[model samples]
Target: MKRDAKNLTNAAALAVFWLAGLTTVVVLGAVIGYVLVNGVGEIGLEFIFTNPHGVNAEGGIWPTIVATLYVTGLAMLIVTPVAVLAAVYLAEYAVQGRLVRTIRFAADTLASVPSIVMGLFGLALFVESMGFGFSVISGALALSFLMLPIVMRTTEEAIRAVPKYIRWGSYGLGASKWQTVSRVVLPAAASRIITGIILSAGRAVGETAVVIFTMGTMINLPVLPTDPGRSMTVHLYQLAMEGINMPAAFGTALLLMAMVLAFNLSARWLLRRNRRMQG
Candidate 1:
């Protein structure tokens, strides 16, 4: 009954896999459900549109929302070019050498480092050394550092996933190195690259520790380059950390989740549009 035993073993493994998958889904659903239930009730039009007021009576999240947008936008602006170029070099230009290996190792190590450590590094470098003094720019720079490894790795993967045939076709057409990459391979791989960027953007939006260290915790809506700002994450952290304000904190957490969910949905829609266009 050797064949019967093998089949039974396989069946047992399948059952375990199914159970594990189900458990994960259930746990995730429960968490999201709880957050939504608690947070949705507190969200309002004013909360969504108004800026954070220093006085508790007047505070809305508008300014925090604006600041969050600014920080995340600036971070993306700074990192996108650098990350894309680095990815291109690693994937297209760099030969298998010591430097390339070193870069790969560095990227992996950076990605694995805990985010709070990155915050501490940013605090030392941007806040202390450069005397950015806890402004939006400093916060944005910190986020850019956090985002670089993720974007670079994803971009490298996307480039690698491009079919060699496409590269060969471009080369056969007498395209130069950059031309082949820009024309055939990059266009073919753009959707995946965008997806990676969107994923990283989500991470940036939710990040608290780096923002907290570099951006500061003042609840006031900050001015542009000269002033400090509180991101939604920072706001949520304040609310959550205050033991007396559980309801407000929960509500803010829910709102943050909603914003993240909205961004994710938008990204998915864009991804689908790109795929359809590509097809």
Candidate 2:
């Protein structure tokens, strides 16, 4: 009787898990399908290549695209090194005491803070205080702060996942602490570190509020880091909110999604290549 009860409970749990998975698939499929169907028709060479014309009612999102790439790239550049280094320190060097705990707690707290709140903070610090004055650099700095905690935590986890045996082996081979960490452990965790970076990039790509607060809605190509610009997300929001260009907004959304997918695929490819070269 107990055996039969156990089997029944397992079956029920399996059914619930399957249902949840199916539901998630259905929902995601529905959203992607709808966006592609509506947006694909609006995409073209001109739509992508040319700048907006006639009060942004018509033309392409070239400037916005450029701005988006600039912000994402600069933000990644700022966050990657800092986060990775911080994670390495936390995982390998820092004594597991109040300081470590406090840092972890701060990261967790920052991660939980809402994006809009972060945007406001960024406005005050980067835009107003730093006198960046509504620019790509300001937006990139804001996004770096938003993504730092995520990248740091993910990197810490990846570093911690490296086997103790590997570290011991390195040490046995006369490698110093820094050498062991840099040459052995980091290479092992390269794929996961890249994955974390990709996740952060995705967040940077989709963020609107932070960009709006730091990078003012300047619909032009930013010639300098300090030049104000509008990201693709900001463009989409402006277009949709003004109710002037629904088609363009949908198209921009599709492009943003495609950019994110491309980033993920590229990161995966890089990881595979790195593994192959390492092997």
Candidate 3:
């Protein structure tokens, strides 16, 4: 009787688990379908490529898209080298000691800080002290702060994912530690590392709070650095907050999602190609 009771309980738990899983799938599918249908319903080629002009809910988002690309590009440029180096040092050369622990703690703290706080820091440092005056550079730097932790964490994981035997084999070949890391281990982990960086790019592109405080809220397609660039995220935030431009805001959101999807898909394709070539 006890054995039979246990079997019944086990079967009940399995049924509940299956039901919960199906519920999750249904909820996610409904949300995604709703957004895609409403958001993609009114977008046209001209709306995407033309610059936003009047503020009376008749503007395009091309300038916003351009600004998003510029700021995200600048952030990636600043983040990639530093994040990769930090990951390399931590994975290949760091002696597991107090210093390593401190660094790890610091990284964790930075990662946990809110995006709005990072924006405030940028407002203080870049906008006030550096005299950047809310330009794309300032916004990019703000985004860099937000992205650095993600890039470093992901890159560290990628580097650590490399097989131990690969490092041993390189050492057996009389390669120096740096050579093994730079030429062998990193190359092996390149696809994953690049994927992490691209993921950070997507985050940077979609960010709103940080850019709003640091990048200023100008709508013109400014000429980068010297002038303010209005990112798509900022535009969406404004539109959504204004409460009367829901359709346009949804459309902008859809475009942003499409951009992120395109980037992720392209990155995956490239990674696959690289893996095939390596194999």
Candidate 4:
């Protein structure tokens, strides 16, 4: 009787888990299918290349695309080096103690903070106090705050994942700490670091609140970093909210999803290629 009860419980648990997985997959498919169905007909080369011109601004999103790229690129430039260096220090140089724990804890706390609050902070500090105004620079700075902790945490985890034996082996070869980190440790952690970067980049690309609050809704091309601009997310939000153009909004959403998906896949492919080459 006990054995039979155990088998029943096991079967019930398996069925529940299977149902949950199936539900998740079905929901994801529904969302993707909806977007693709609504947006595919609206996507075209002309819609992507030219500036918005017609009534209700129902033209292409060229300037917004450029601004999004500029903002995301600048944020990456600002955050990547600093986050990586911080991760290296925490993972390699710092003694595992209260201070290290505090830093990690602080990073976690900061990451948990609401993104709208970060946007407001950026509005106060970068846009007004720093006199950047509604510009790409302000947006990039604002977005960097969001990306920093993500990159740092992921990188530190990746670096710590490297085996202690590898470092000891490097030291066995009379290599300095910096030499081992630069030659052995970093190479091993590179793929995971790239994955972190890609994750942060995907977040950066889709950010609307921070970009909208900092960059302002300027359809003009961002010729300079200080120039005010609009990103795709902001444009999509405006279109959807104001009921200006539903088709264009759907197209923007689809394109945004595609950009993130393509970037993610490409980064993973590169990591796989690197692994194979190293092997």
Best by lDDT: 2
- Ten-residue segment with the worst summed lDDT in candidate 3? 51-60
Q: Write the per-residue lDDT of candidate 3 for residues 102-127, one digit (tens) a residue.
A: 88788889988999999999999998
State the lDDT of candidate 4 residue by residue for 1-279, as single tens digits: 999999999999999999999999999899889999999888999889989987688779999999999999999999999999999999999999999999999999988888899999999999999999999999999999999999999999989988999999999999999999999999999988988888889889998989989999979999899999999999999888999999999999999999988778977887788779767
Task: Give lDDT tens digits, candidate 1, residues 13-93.
Answer: 999999999999999899999987877776789767766544342436777777888888889999889999999999999
Clash pairs (backbone) in predicted model 2 = none
Regions of candidate 2 where Cα sits further than 4 Å from its true position: 1-19, 268-279
How much lDDT does each candidate structure score? Answer: 0.83, 0.93, 0.87, 0.92
What alpha-carbon RMSD in Å does predicted model 3 have with respect to the real structure?
A: 2.3
**271: Cα error in model 3, Å:** 5.2
Q: How high is the lDDT of residue 154 in model 2?
A: 93
Query: Which candidate leads in TM-score?
Result: 4
* TM-score (C-alpha, index-matched) for candidate 3: 0.90
Please give the clash total of every predicted structure, in order.
3, 0, 0, 0
> Ten residues in a row with the worst lDDT in model 2?
270-279
lDDT of 2 at 13: 100
How do the residues 89-164 of candidate 2 rate in per-residue lDDT, one tens digit apiece? 9999999999999999999999988989989999999999989999999999999999999999999998998899
TM-score ranking of the models? 4, 2, 3, 1
